[model samples]
Target chain A: MSKGKIYLIPTTLGDSPINDVLPPKTIDILSQLQHFAVENIRTTRRYIKKVIPEKDINQITFHLLNKHTSISEIRHILQSVEQGIDLGIISEAGNPCIADPGSLLTREAHRNNLQIIPLTGPSSILLALISSGMNGQNFAFNGYLPISPQERIKKLRQLEKKSQSEQQPQIFMETPYRNKQMIESIIKTCHPETLLCIATNLTLSNEFIKTAPISYWKKHIPEIHKQPCIFIIGA
Target chain B: MSKGKIYLIPTTLGDSPINDVLPPKTIDILSQLQHFAVENIRTTRRYIKKVIPEKDINQITFHLLNKHTSISEIRHILQSVEQGIDLGIISEAGNPCIADPGSLLTREAHRNNLQIIPLTGPSSILLALISSGMNGQNFAFNGYLPISPQERIKKLRQLEKKSQSEQQPQIFMETPYRNKQMIESIIKTCHPETLLCIATNLTLSNEFIKTAPISYWKKHIPEIHKQPCIFIIGA
Candidate 1:
């Protein structure tokens, strides 16, 4: 029997409307699939219901794939595909495999010669980069920064230096509650002329996406505590 | 009068259907905008008609922003926004600003304090990365590698070393016709055990996406000549 293809489905970021963020065909594909490997079961089920109100939640089988999911469990999920049952990886927000545990399953899919299809949808990292007016041609995503203050400051300096040398934009995110501290570290560790873009509340109402020099950010301190943010440092 | 915002619009990759790659709201947004800064006027008009066949093409004003477009011309496009006329940037394919000159206009928009809205859509780079199942948590998009054979080999060596040291995946592309030569350089320059992913014709019917070690690729050289491709090197 031919194996089922693994679809890497993308979810909306924050509270953005489904229609506004996802293609119509994404909904169509989701309704047809009966199995999913999701990060958060509650959010994924709710999202599925919200997008396709008529979809029967009871008919679907979801496999948990959070921090605690084991390799054997992921292998089992792939085994279901080996039985010709297609499965999808759904993240709580944004595209799967990006800043999520979905990559573990995707890597396995590649290892086992499973076909992987990545759908088009909202990605805060990509959205933030284009909107920042920074160097999009060459950029790096370093995921979240070091939580320790000293290490975070050192990392910020290294990022700034690399950006200057390579002429490439550096992208990094922070824990929601620690966003304010992240901004301060960026402002203090980088030169005054270095550009810093702070993109917060993406894809939601009252979104704030702006890029300015460190000096300007220092003079006008932003109130972004508790808000999810993507920071980019540019030469 | 309030300042008109700049919208960063995305176009479909290859011959993929519009509905499959873009949200319905994107079409709605494009039809409402009267001015566009595009990489190619002919292709943009053709794509606009293909997506919204009922819309009147005569009402739209297209500003040329290709290789010959000067800084002064891009500045004029932004100036139109000063008159409260909203404008959109449309690339030849995929999202604007990445691997295109659209960012020059976007950078000026940021300097002038114009609000920029980047719509979510098909980004080949992001799609390739997600589908590759590599280290999406930390990766870099380095645009295109050096075209010269010697420089290309040296660059591949450097990329492989960086991927090994930083444990970060490096992504780069090549002109369509030179894809075969690029693969040859990668196979010859990198270590046998290094992982490489070749994603070609993404979001199309005959899409080919796979990842394997350099040794495997050497044994099975891909016939990706004249096909647009994204190459990724992982540790």
Candidate 2:
């Protein structure tokens, strides 16, 4: 049999179905596929449940395809594709491949000359930038801040300077646990009047978008620590 | 009356609804607003008609708010918001405020402490970037290249050097008519080995994504200039 196509599906980050609007039809398309390679089987099961609330989870076959999975598993996924088995790849949130492990699969697929179809969906980074009134004409998305506090601050400083020089915006994010420290670093290191945007709980009821100079944030010291957030510093 | 919220709704670039996937709920929200500010009132009205097929065009007001519009008009838009009248703003296509006239209004809203809600929807830049299989981690979407051919080539050269030195992707596009010329310049100026991605008709049926070194584009000159495209140069 001839090889089948690859579909990169987008998943929601948290409770907001607002971003998952296309998942129902997406799942319908995946149902006809031969394999559904998901970031996490259990998580994908939960998402599939939420997307098609009336369906039974027991009917779906989800294969785990995250970082922990070995190389052999990936080869098996490729082999399935080679056998004309349609494959559906999904992330835990947003579109797959960007700052996600699924990129490796996408790269491999391209190398093998497989047909890859990317479905349209919500992206937290773009949503944050579009909503935050920053230099949208030119902006950079640096997936996540460095883990080390010192390195992260250095990166933020670089981001701020780049934005200023190019009159472009720099975008980055931090894990929930490290968000507060990231904010503190921005407050201490960035210039007083430097523009900064913090987008949190995007697409959810608790969503908040704060855009102001670094000085403004210093005054309030927002409680940003345990939230999934995106940071943008403008030049 | 309490001041109403201002929303930056994203529409598509052309006359078709295929590129537009904004939910019906967003259209309903847009229809109820007293002031609807758009990049081109005529074009926006045509797109809005596609989304809300049954709405009476006479019932809704569309304010032309392109760069040519005066500050008084913008002030009036703000005044409407201040007076508790909700307003809707849209660009010709994709999300407003990003490389669109809505940015100025958004900045003004930020300064005035008015609520600005960004609904999740189509984004031409992100759609193009993600589909290109280019470096999405570190990317800069420079709005448009210089109109003059000499300046455009110079800017491309500068962006090429910056992209190489900094290990970041640089994205820029030309107006529809000049796309062919830009492609020719990119082929001539950029090194043969440098990767170039042309994402055209994004999110539509005839959508095309071509990622190749300048060498490959030089070979396929005929097909490259066929559509409205976004040119991405990846390091």
Candidate 3:
């Protein structure tokens, strides 16, 4: 009989200083894992070195598990847990099974009856939602807008209509460089009265969560074209 | 001018045992607050003493604050901050401002331009949503449904229809003791094929996050009528 084992630890939001705020017990658990499933092996190695500097952490090899990984790799992850090996899964930042990369693995872990453990840490989505003061009762997170301007506008329009009719909040993110275009699309396509929330640099020294009507945004965010940001519209 | 003062600091769920899981810096911040505004000052004081035994937290008084407190009392809180006093806001458990008691104070703090610090902690709603594998992209937290079954059902039906039509996720909670009827109501009113998630004992030893179609839940959930659960229906 194998020991029950599964760990889903939260990493920090990649570019924030608060990104380094993992609990001590989580670090202790990381050191105990027989194999660490990391989104980026190089970055994971550096993070571990910072905490456990004197140890040979490289002995515990990392299995890169990103979106491109084959389904076979998921099976190996399940197999390792079945053998009683504690497996630590982490995204580049924030909670793993969230809007981040580890949901597929988490779904499989659930099916296999593995003991899933969720550790505490920074979560950009929750922070944005709570502070947005929009509707917290009913909200949806649309991961990323289409990069093409036309497609992005089309999706934004659909989201806006759905959000308004249902009185539910709609949230989405954009690449650092494409932020301006996304904001512009929101201004052009969304109702001027629509409530828009921009949460940028969350949990960092410069964390900001701003909520304003769409018309007000056009006047202020003239040059915010390219920055990694989470945009929210409350119906 | 007096130094900028501390504001509310909501922590993770469960007993203070979970507090041990927070980052070290968070603990340091909690310690520095000269005053803690909590639902139960005694409980908060006891929790602080248990977690950080060496620190004499007696000098840091706790001002009991709850939903019953008046607007003038809220002003008094701000006045203390103006006098260079620090404040820590804690709920019975979990993060504040999520249908919790400290929201008024939080708003007041924001209006006053006081530096509001939100610590990364557990939120039952987020825990339930992420683990349930429901629609995470957009969610609306309705807080708690009406106590009367008829009103509750009406709200549930409205939410169900809206969710289905808009593809939005609706979230709500019930007191721990009222968990059973909430589940039954959903099983009877929501469509048989509708997806429902029941998250209970979040961040606690007995925590469980369960999901199933309403029809399946109707037949399987004999012990889950009123048990302090958060229900999620994903359209």
Candidate 4:
């Protein structure tokens, strides 16, 4: 029997409309699958219901695969795929296996020689980069910076230097609650003339994306408290 | 008057169904726009027609923004947006302003203080990484590799070393016709234990994606001549 495929499904970024970010084909696949390995079972259930209202939330099987999931447990999750049962992996938001715990399952799926398919969907990082007007041809996504204030400042300086010398934009994000502090740290650490782009609430009706010099942002800082944002710095 | 927004549109990867990669909202936005700055006028027109067949193609205005477009011409393209006319930027395939010529227009739009909006759509690089089972939290997209054989080999070795030391995957692509040669160079240059993932014809029915060590690839090489492929090297 052919091994079942592992599909990397993408969810909406925030409160964006379901049809705005996901294609009909993705929804079709979600409706057909009965098994899912997700970062958060609650959010996965809510998202599935949003996309497929007819789907029985109670009938679907959900396996936890967050940061707390053990490596051994990931192997057990792939057992279903090996047994000819197709499985889907969904993150809390955005595309799975990207800045999310879904990669653990996909990594294990490869070790088991299972076919992996990634369905099309929204990705905040790509949306931020393409709209930043910075160097998209060459860029590094460092995920998140050091949480400590002092260490974060040091890292910010390093990123600025790298961006100027390499002519490559540096992309990173911070926890939503710390979004304002992250922006403040960027303003306080980088040179006044450096270009910084902040994209918040992407794909939503209240989406805001702008890129300007640090000096310009210092005079008119936007409120991004407790909101998801992707920051990019370049010369 | 409020400045017109610049929408960074996404085109299909290949000959995939229109509804498979793009959302209905994107099509709605595409149908409403009358002007577009595109990498290739022919492909952009074909894509627009596929998505919005009822629209009159002759009524739309297409401005070429490929490698040959000059800085002065880009400034002229933004003039329409400044006049309160929204414009869309489309690449030959995939998302605009990403390893494509659309960035020039976006950068200029930012300099003019225009609102830049990136609609949700398919991105091949992100799809490849998400499916590669590689590091997605911290990764770098190096776009295309050097063309010279010696330079390409040196770059491949550098990428392999970076992947091992940084624990970050390095992604790069090659021209479709040079797909096989690129794979040969990678296998010949990287260490046997280094993991390499090759994803080709992504989002299409005949799509093929695989991840394995360099040694495994050397023994069972796949034919991918004249195919769009993304390669990732990781430990």
Candidate 5:
């Protein structure tokens, strides 16, 4: 049997309609796939149902992968693909492998020489980036900061210095609930003249993207507690 | 009059069908816009025609923005938006403000406090990253390399060191025509153990993506001459 290809599918950022962020081809491909490796089975099922409602959800098989997933299990998941069963890796939010655990499976796919196809969709990182009006020509996405206050602040200083020397925007994110604390750290640790961009609730109705210096952000910080946000530190 | 939004629209990476990469909202927004800021007028006009065949192309007003465009010109283009005229920034290929000159307009819009809504679409950089099976959690896109071979090799060394130090992938690209030169430089300079990913003709019918060590690549280098490509150096 011919080896099945692995489709790297993307899910919506939030409650926004799928049509607003995804192409028609994504749904067309999802309808034919019966095996999937997903970050969250429930969310992936819901996303698939939103576009391909006719499918019998019970007929499909799901493999759950997270930070706890092991390499042996990842290889086990690909056994189906080895036998000509196609698999799709769907993330809870955004593109698989981007700020998510999808890359683990993708890496294994490369090892096995399986065809991996990545579909285009709503990526908060890319969306926040294009809207920030920062330096998009050259930028980096440093997924998340350290949880420790001191370590996080030190990392911020390092990113800020790199952004200045390279004249590039340094992009990063934080856990939703800790948005305020992240804001405070940036405001306090970075230079006053350093430009910062805070992009929150992207693709949703209440989307907000603003770029300003640390001094301006000190007095007008928004209520982004528990909101998904992307932060960029640049010139 | 209420202010109009600056729609950061995206074009296809190559000749892939519009519906294959862009969402329905993109064509909807493009149909209604009478003003556009584009990298190249001819390509943008052709793109609009492909999606909105019935619309008369002549009625739309386009402001060309490129490497040579001045900040004053970008501000002048926004005069209509200030008067509630919706404007879309279209690039020759892929998303605007990403490895394109569209950010000048986006930056000016931010300066004026205009609403900048970035629509989702194909981004070669993001697509390549997700497909690479590399560390997408932490990565950087250094848009291009120095034309001079020596400087280009030096920059490659810097990126490779940074990649090894951070355990992050350093993504970069080169002008299509000089792709072979780039591949040669990587084979000759980068460490044998270093991993490299070369994604070519992304989103097109003939897409190619592969990640392997420099030693493995030395024995088998694919023909990527004069083809749009993205390269990544990682651990």
Candidate 6:
């Protein structure tokens, strides 16, 4: 029997309408799948219900695959797929296997030689970069910066230097609750003339995406506490 | 009057059905817009018609914004938007302002303080990375490699080293026509153990996305001449 395919599904960025981010076909596919490896089972169940309310939640099986999931357990999750049972990988939000632990299962799928399909949807990282008015051709997504004050400052300086020298924008994210601290560091560590873009609550009703010189941002920092955000710095 | 918003529109990767990649709301927005800043007028026109066939081709105004477009001309394209006329930016394929010259106008939009909205859609780069089973948390998209053979080889070596040392996947593309040459260089230059993923014809009927070590790829190289492809390297 042919190995089952793995679909890399994308969820809405926040509470945005599913119609605004996901295609109808993606929904159709979601309705058909009976198994999933999700970052958070509760959130995934809620998201699936939001998209396809008619979906029988109890009919579906969820395999946990978050940061805490062990490597050995990941291999076991693919056993169903190896036996010709198609599976879907869903993240807590946005696309799976991206800055999320879904990669662990996806990597295992490859080892088992299962085909992988990625559906179209909103990607906050790409959305932020395109709207930042900065270099998009060449950019680096550093995921999250170091937590320590000194290391974060050093990393920020290094990113600023690379942005200026290579004409490449440096993109990164911070823990939502630490958004304020991240902005504080960005303003204090980077050159005044550097351009910084703060994209918060993307694709949501209260979305705020803007770019300005660091000096200007220092004078007008927006409150982004407990809000998902993506930052980009460029010269 | 409030400045008009700039919508970053996404086009199909190939001749795939629009319903497969773009949301219905995106189509509704496309149907309502009368102005667009596009990479290729002909292809953009074709895409618009495919999405909303009821749209009157003669009623819409198209502003060219490809590599050949002068910097000064990009500013002129946003004049209508500045006057409160909503505008959409479309690329030949995939998302605009990303590895595309649409950024020139997007930058101008920010300078003019126009709201920029990026609709959700397929991004081959992001799609390839998510499906590659490689490191997705931290990755760099180096748009294209150097054309010169020596420089190309050197860049490949650098990318491989980065992939192994940092576990950060390196993604880059090649001119469709030069796809074969790019693969030849990858097989001939990088270490036999280095993993390389070549994702081609994404979101299309005949899409092929796979990852394997350089040694395995050397023994079985797929024909990708004149095909749009994204290549990723990781440990």
lDDT for each residue of candidate 2 in A99-134, tens digit (9 for 90 to 100): 667756765665576767666566789878877778
What TM-score against the true fold does each predicted structure earn?
0.98, 0.91, 0.83, 0.99, 0.98, 0.98
Would candidate 5 be rated incorrect, acceptable, medium or high by CAPRI criteria?
Answer: high
lDDT of 3 by residue, A130-183 (tens): 666566455667777788889999999988997898776788888778777778
The best candidate by lDDT is 4
Window of ten residues with lowest summed lDDT in model 5 chain A: A106-115
lDDT of 2 by residue, B128-194 (tens): 6665566656778898999888999999999889779876778887777778899888988999988
Cα deviation at B75, candidate 3, in Å, is 4.4
lDDT of 2 at B121: 60
lDDT-best of 4 and 5:
4
TM-score of the second chain, each candidate in turn, equals 0.97, 0.93, 0.92, 0.98, 0.98, 0.97
Per-residue lDDT of A202-229 in model 5, one digit per residue for the tens?
9899999998889989999999999999
RMSD, each candidate, Å?
1.1, 2.6, 3.7, 0.9, 1.1, 1.0
Worst 10 residues of 6 chain B by lDDT: B104-113
lDDT of 6 by residue, A83-190 (tens): 888999999779998889988888877777789999999999999998998877888888899999899999999999999998989999999999999999999999
lDDT string, candidate 1, B59-142, tens digits: 999999876889999888889898899999999888898988888888888889999988878988999999988987899999
The residue pairs that clash in candidate 4, if any, are: none
- Model 6, B1-235: lDDT tens per residue? 8778899898889999988989988888999999988888898888888899888999999988888998778778777788888999999778898888888887777777889998888899999999999877899899989999999999999999988887889999999999999999999999898889999999999999988899999999999999999999999
DockQ of 4: 0.85
For each predicted model, how many residue pairs clash, with residues at least 3 apart or on different chains? 0, 7, 27, 0, 0, 0
Off-target runs (Cα >4 Å) in candidate 3 are A15-20, A69-73, A133-138, A150-169, A187-195, A212-219, A222-227, B2-8, B37-42, B53-58, B61-76, B79-85, B157-169, B190-195, B213-228
Which residue pairs of candidate 5 clash? none
Residue A148, model 2: lDDT of 89
Candidate 3 on B1-235: residue-level lDDT in tens?
Answer: 7645544455656563644357766677777767877888877877677656777876787777787989898888778887777787877766665676675675566456565656677777776766765554555677888999999999999989967886767888888778887887888899998878777766677767766678878788846444457788865
CA shift of A76, model 1, Å: 1.4
